[model samples]
Target: MTKMKNESNLKVTFCKRKSGLFKKFSELITLCGAEILLLVFSPTKRVFSYGHPSVDEIVGPLFGYPVRRVEKLMEVEEQHGKKINHDKKVGQDQRWWERSNKEMSYQQLEHLKMSLLNLNAIVTQKMLEFSNP
Candidate 1:
């Protein structure tokens, strides 16, 4: 009925719930011979996904998905990556948390947020003893 207020317990709960949830997904696929794609984003924006057979196989055609735009998108992403690589801080590597929000576009800002989320998830999961997070 209420969100868990304790951070330590909440993180532990997250790991347990994530494990049980993924196990159920696997069971559904195996028992029913189902084709399923699951994408879960936690409260911190960490990404977790499960796809049977494969995500591409189970997902439908994008319905007039722009292949041309995908090429352009890849090119843009490549350039962005190069920019980040070159924009290192004076004494240390530039981290997502260190980047200035004002310089980022809305999409970039979102990507930054997700990166941080993933990083936080990794750190939390690693710091804990359990294998799942």
Candidate 2:
């Protein structure tokens, strides 16, 4: 393994090494019937995963992780159904103008005004910079 001094170099090296490692793992699984689950977290905290069958299927059963029950699944399905119905009702109930120009609260209006002012100031500054430079 080559040592990398810089963050950019390290990230590049990590990607190369990770790809090689996964290739070897795949070969091992195909030739030797070895079950494998590999999980690597990058320097940026992004996850990289490789598994023979699947990461969850092998790890969950081996580690005695709790599997979802029928009741829990039903509850999730019910919640999703409610959300879909509510969304449909909301879309159906509102007219085009009502949906387009939503009535903002006093606080929301003030927040919007301030945001617009800040954006205007930034644009003015950029214009001045461009004109001068």
Candidate 3:
């Protein structure tokens, strides 16, 4: 009975420390904008982690501590995903446009050409309508 009680107390301490570490990890990530992954196994054989992409994806390749390229690729992937998700949410949603009435004026000639082509189509449509009337 004493051994069981000791084991139980140990478990409770382990759980509390694990939760505290997880919270600290999250806070560090939030404050520093660094990609971090932690792998912890308790005495009872449990796994825990905290990271942006994942602990394994970040840490497994170079035998712990991912190379700079890997971290950069992960960041790019995350940014791309965020952009795609934002586009999906903002597309056809006038609420976003209403909040930020902004447009990027940085233009490429290719984009300008496409815009001109669209304008031509609209002009042609209007001319056809007038002629028909």
Candidate 1 lDDT by residue in tens digits, 9-127: 88888877986887798889889999887766676766666667643344324333233533454455557656765665567545543445576556557665554454344434433
Candidate 3 lDDT, tens digit per residue, 1-133? 2434577888888877877787788778779977886656667864454555554355445344334644565466557545544655345442332122134222223333343344344334433554675
How far does residue 94 in candidate 1 sit from its true spot (Å)? 40
Error of 2 at 97 (Å): 48
How well is each residue in 1-133 modelled by candidate 2, as lDDT tens digits?
Answer: 5667799989998988887887789889989999897767678865566666754356557645443542354355457545544554344542221121255445334544454344344334433554676
lDDT of candidate 2 at residue 72, scale 0 to 100: 56
Assess candidate 3 and give its TM-score to the true structure: 0.41
What's the candidate order when arranged by decreasing lDDT? 1, 2, 3
Give the TM-score ranking, best first. 2, 1, 3
State how far residue 30 of model 3 sits from its true place (Å). Answer: 0.2
Segments in model 3 whose C-alpha atoms lie over 4 Å from true places: 1-5, 60-133
Q: CA lDDT of 27 in candidate 2?
A: 85
TM-score of 1: 0.46
Clashes of each: 0, 0, 0
Report clash pairs, candidate 2.
Answer: none
